[model samples]
Target chain A: MSHIPLEEGVPGIRSLVMYRPDTGKPLYELAQVLLRDESPLSPAERELIATYVSHKNTCKFCASSHAAAARYLFDQESGVVDLVLDDYQSAPISDKLKALLTIAGRVQEDARTVSDEDVALARSFGANDRDIHDTVLIAATFCMFNRYVDGLATLTPTEDAAYAQMGERMGTIGYVLPQKPA
Target chain B: MSHIPLESHLPGITGLLEYRQDSAKPIRELTQLLLRGESTLTEAERELIATLVSSRNQCRFCTTAHKSAADILLGESETCEMVINDFESAPVGEKMKSLLAIAAHVQKNGKNVTEGDVIRARNCGATDREIHDTVLIAALFCLYNKYVDGMASFTPTDPAFYKKLGERITTVGYNRLPGGYDQLKTQS
Candidate 1:
């Protein structure tokens, strides 16, 4: 149950966003731009960044749903999503992505703790200014999102299929505002 | 200076926003809606929540910038300092204290905010909207604090800078600044 009365059966942030469309609209727009719109980062990589941060925050709904989306986006390389989630260091991904994820993890734990060495490491991996900036922003944004969903204690559906559908929708269509229940 | 090359004259989030206008657009709109949009919580109250969370996150740029905006909105009372230092002991009303408590918990970790905290806020005469907005405001600043600090963006040392910036926030709002980032360079 959510902290406030929300439309029944709607899950996670969708319910919360429906609860306040004024604030929700901007949030959705931000997500769409960050995850789907034109950027140096591919949609798969961006989704992975969001998933990585949410997993660190222990935000079950965000983690599961985003992980599913990352998997969908990764397609043939889908297995890497769980591998990175479990322990990114050993995950079979590009060194550049690993470096970026390292920075993202640091941002999740404590932004101030993300030292110069971290930025240098990402740059060494051929990450440009945009890459590093987007990675940090993505991580930071998810921190806000993770808290928003859990702070209200929104409903989290239990089944894997639920997340699979969410993952596919996010991977394909990107983020859009959840409409109010009719 | 930021971790990446940015307009040297601009400070904090202004420089970052300039760095990527595409992403910055939505972020700016969200800030406008969360902080300046119509709500039961006054702009001052919302700014207070942002200041408190930024202070806890130890993001000097965000803490100082928002604290100044909150001070101007609060006018003569200027309770932002005390509130940031210790909202629990601050002289704010029960409703505000309760909402700040919720905001504080959200700052530490979302799970830290228990159901009891929400109920207590309700008891303090906080409406659902107030509680909801408080959490969102706190959450939003967490993003801002991290974004500013994560990249090691510039943090102005002069108090005067914050004073003017604060005035700008209250007057100009988040959607559009008076002179925009390019003009911010000359102002300081």
Candidate 2:
């Protein structure tokens, strides 16, 4: 059973959102702008940023779902998302992304730890203001999402393939709230 | 020295938001809902949650601002200070302390929160909604603290300034605060 009386097996933030739609609406809107909508960072890259932070936080549901979205968005290779999460330093992603991920990693642990050198590094790699700003927000925001899901002890499917299926739906429908279990 | 070239010297997240109102509007709206919107948790308690998290994150600007707001709603200054320094010894009831303990754990690490914490809170008379609200408050401030300090925004120096601002907050309210932080310069 969840911390609250949620349904049997709604995973991650999904169940929590159903519990409180008032908070959920803004959280979804934030995600829509941060991950779904377009900007300097491609939607795939944004999802990857979220995926990386969720992975660092060790939230399985978030990491898996976002990796699937990233894989769906970027067709160059299937394993690329996993590869980058494991070792973004060596992964084939652009230097700009690597730099942004470095900052994201800091935000995951301690926001105060992000230094002038980190900002300079991203700039050196050609990440402009908006790119860096969105990356930090995505990483920081996922911390909240990851905690909200895990804090409440929401149920998440363990099978990695389940995330792929959910990811397909998310890719098609975006971050709309699903009906609560009856 | 922000990641973005935000111009305001105004303290805390305001400077960062001043750079981009498009991003700021929804965040502002969310805070309005969470902090000021009608809830089982009084606005004071919500602000207390926010203040406690900021103190843990060591974000001076937010700690000062929200603590003042908490004080205003609570109508007592020493209790607010005691809660921050040591809630166990503070005059607050056990239920509020239990909720604060959960919030503290959340500020430290989300994974640390366990079923036992909820059980303890329930034993102390916290409802499901109260427990849920505490978790959200802790988690949300984790986001806000980063938004404030992650970009190296200014921190106001005078304690009196925060007290005055706190007194005004009840009347003006969070929703009434400027949406476009870029225009903050002119208002200041």
Q: Would you list the clashing residue pairs of candidate 1?
A: none
Tell me the docking grade of candidate 1: high
Q: Count the backbone clashes (under 3 Å) in each candidate.
A: 0, 0
lDDT (10s digit) by residue, model 1, range A24-111: 9889988998889887899999999999999999899999999999999999999999999888989998888999999999888889
TM-score of chain B of each: 0.95, 0.88
Residue A80 accuracy (lDDT) in model 2: 80
For model 1 the local lDDT of residue A123 reads 87
TM-score of every candidate: 0.98, 0.94
Off by over 4 Å in 1: none
Q: Over the stretch A71-161, how does candidate 2's per-residue lDDT look in tens digits?
A: 8888667678989988999998898899899999998888888888999999998888888788888888888888777777778788978
lDDT tens digits, residues B1-188, model 1? 57898888888998898888888888888899889988988999899899999999999999999988988998844588899888988878899999999999998778888989998999989998888889888999999999999999989999999999899899988975655666655555
lDDT of 2 by residue, B51-105 (tens): 8888988888888998998888988888778888988888888888888889988
Candidate 1 chain B, poorest ten consecutive residues by summed lDDT: B178-187
